[model samples]
Target: MSSRERVLAAVAGVAGIAAAATLATPGAAASGRYQHWDDTAYRGQIEVVRSADGPSDPTVLNGTVFVDRDRDSRHDRNERGLAGVEVSNGREVATTDSRGRYRLPVYDNMTVFVTQPAGYQVPVDEFNVAQFHYNHLPAGSPDLRYGGIAPTGPIPDAVNFPLVESRLTDDRRLSCIIAGDLQTYDLDEVEYARKGAIADLARRNDYQGCGSLFVGDVVGDDLSLYDEVKGLTAQTNGPARFLPGNHDLDFDATTAEHSFDTFRAQLAPAYFSYDVGNAHIIALNTVRYPCTPELDNADGLRPECDDPVNRPRYNGAIDATQLEWLRRDLAKVDRDKLIVIAGHIGLLNWADEGSAIHQVDQVREVYSLLHGRKAVALAGHSHSIENLRTGDSMQGWRDLFGVQSLPFPHLTVGAIAGDWYSGQVTEAGYPTALQRDGGRPGVLTLDLHDSSFQERFTVTGESDRVQTQLGLNSPTYREWYVARSAWNRNPVGAAPELGDPLVVDQADLAGGTWLTTNVFMGATGSTVTVRLDDGRPRAAVRTQAMQGEDQLVGPEWSDPVAVAEQLVHGGSVADRTMHLWRFALPADLSPGTHRAHVTATDIHGRRFTDSLTFRVVASR
Candidate 1:
């Protein structure tokens, strides 16, 4: 049969695959422009009773979590208080009593927030930002560049939190979106993001309840852009939540306590938790800015951190106070629920698998806390898509963090601003923005049923159908890579692109040539198989085994498809990835045009198929 016939056959075969039926959901299907919830739709807020003389007892703060029957931000006499709700002062977890009233010891500077319980939701402002927290910084933060938090004078008389009932939040089946690094440096980049992922999210209403948790780096160094970035979230169909990144820090703050004050003022609590369905999502503040030698384990490992005066580097760490809070927070959660531990920096990741500063320093301790619980960690500092499953290990994880292997899956959800939004601009109104792992910019959706979930990644303007990228790794491509990579470093002129990537000569087949498959979310137990036209299917081996092995990198391990775009245009080179798989071609094959059909079955047992045709000439 001709190559065109084979392509048609492969397309037809995909229709019969049972997994294809489960690809997209009705709520995920693109309707016209989604009508997002405006301010008039839900007007709820925490009732703060302030006094001219302030609270008599400054050490103790009292609050009530009440049912907002009138949809108002007040605690009316008729509206009853909700009991058994969780509240926090950033360090301690407090539960509401029988009457929904609770008292907690107050601190000088802390955010008192209520964890939006299942079956109900906290109030959202104009931008759909959940307003659950009340900052209690009496004197506020010290003088900082970004106007850190303005002085929130003495504690209010009663910080009454108002919550509204919602059937969406109570559903057993939930879809939670984990988006990383919107990281817009300027308004132009913001527009790129608006047209890309934000636009895609705006069209879907599936995640209206669980909403979108933007992991970190909301804006590049400009905290001034927080307002602009929050405006983009208004277009999305759900409540938008956030955690702070190194970029989101108020750099002028000399003390670490006030580093993220401005971020908390604009976005969310630095660390907080909420419940939806059977999932308990915990957003942690993992970035420790201006990490000095004074901190434990920072003396010798990081040189940039030595000079807090000039360098002022950030490290992936959880402070003692926050760690204590985590223990208290977990104590209140039911072990049956799925615990999603999210942060800006990964607890452990493939990109920085060996680096001590990039991965969280307290990973081992955090693991011990969730020892027997069902949990999954999600992060996005590295700008790579990593689906590291249970028992997956790297040399760095064992060496630095003392973690032998992952007890639970830790996923580095790829960034919204892919590779800092670099590469060629596409007609879709955004840059191609290919990631460091060769994965396209996308958001991760955890479709949960009870406590279990199936993770799916939807590319920014593409459907879930687009998952894998196909490429041929020939001996000739390697030679071009070395030459062009050097030229990219020190460009003399326009660097030449890879020539005839699909055409392999006799030398290429003899030396080494194979078909490479880059599965964006491939994890352990995931399998890739390649079938030549009319031939039996052969198994493809994963490049990085992720079983206590050091990272394997170089031209031989690179994705030719991603390298071509990065070297010619602009983006991080996809030199190493845990999700790459390859199938070696036989050297004894006759020279002719050939077609290969590739099928990748993920750990969730969902299968995705793609086909590529290449020419095998007798000689170059």
Candidate 2:
């Protein structure tokens, strides 16, 4: 069978089993299943009440945001309508009147959705996926695989939205979870996600209000696994929302307009924004499938996308319509509130800092929109953790996108399905899936208080305290890295092991020895200091200065500790990272065991310390 057919069959098989299966919370009783937000007996749906003779005006669509006190999907006579609730038709924004009624101009191929006002909660499906939008496609999608959105005829006389009051979103302080790349290929990878990142989110109650916003790549090429993917979110504590990534596209589609039709029908609008606390979180769709030469702004770097026949590919871009929508969306947002811009691909990142097809093309326009306001960009796709601060620039960004420096902080939150779940399985029921930058599978959270926020990354099944990874980089290890890396390219036999990584000889130190620290979220203004046993603290220099320079890659900039695990077990090499810091070891150390303590201070002034021990022998 063809690969597409195989994917469809796999999706069909999983969907049947997923419908009957329940994702039990970790350590909870088998019978104790978490309840969905909109599992009412009345069948939760937007109350699209229509007149017997159809609507008087088809051009204008009307809606009401009502309080669903009885938990019914319908808006009862007694149930009052919510006032000043925001609603949109992808481009135009409208708010509910005093009577909770909102009217917007109707259009083809538009998604009508509510902003989900603060102090109120939107109902969720059985998979814990938030239900706040309705798709209106008059004629439906053209012939395509994965069956895009079905036809929804004329506009209803009234499309009322149901909501319930919640104190969770009312708080001024919010903890917003930004999970990246849950790129599960099949059912097995789905299980790994359930055990890894989903379990971590299930165990936490801190983000119930702002909820968990998964930043793209919800699955691999199999769009049919969306249901199985949604089942994982059923185990989490908050209303799960999602953004579209390159992997999440319906590749069978020919046009860019219908590229994400299946995703929008199943997950969310391609791009949208909502307000919570003092922050206006804008979720963007930065990926454009089948990018033609007319659309690509990569300065001919992405000639691969120019081919529509043999190799129709996706490019990191924001269409003119989406950019205009973003401008309109920002105008409505308060200037004092923090603007949290999120997408699948970053505006610019450390891993793909030099790749034009990997970063957004319209990033400069986006920066101009929030010219002086307090804003931060968050993204996935790179599968690396990067906490880049203002003024961080790269030669590629300067040459390709005409961007010299970052206007504000831009972060690439590490993926939950690290390196596509490519490593050995651990006792925790998940893969040791180390990322490209030597970071583990984890989720990022923005701890926001009013207009200010701090970013934190929690490694899967690990505590927040476990931030930095320590390793020894010596001449011996560098040689092992070169050998193993070459062998990894064309495997023939058992791989060469990095022996006694912490041990080094006189010649090894003389050739250049250093202690490497991979601070997962370390950025500019952050400092890494190392202290030997009973010695003064010595400063460690960051490998990448991020000051309009080219990427410093290879073994010299690698995290030896992480590379050891990846090469022996199986995963991406930690060859290059923007967060690595190295402290040169003294060559004249005595022939004995020595201890080194590492302390990394972040841009937020928060400090995390780790320690490692190594031996100094006369000869190996």
Candidate No. with top lDDT: 1
- The residue-by-residue lDDT of candidate 2 on 375-440, one tens digit each, is 999999999999989888899889888998989999899999988897667768988778999887
Which stretches of candidate 2 lie above 4 Å from their native place? 1-44, 492-494
Query: Candidate 1 clashing pairs?
Result: none
lDDT score for residue 577 of model 1? 86
TM-scores, each model vs. reference: 0.94, 0.91
Task: Estimate the TM-score for candidate 1.
Answer: 0.94
Report lDDT (Cα) of residue 512, candidate 1.
91
Clash total of candidate 1:
0
Which ten contiguous residues of candidate 2 have the minimum total lDDT? 12-21
Best by TM-score: 1
Looking at candidate 1, what is the lDDT of residue 570?
Answer: 77
How many clashes show up per model?
0, 0
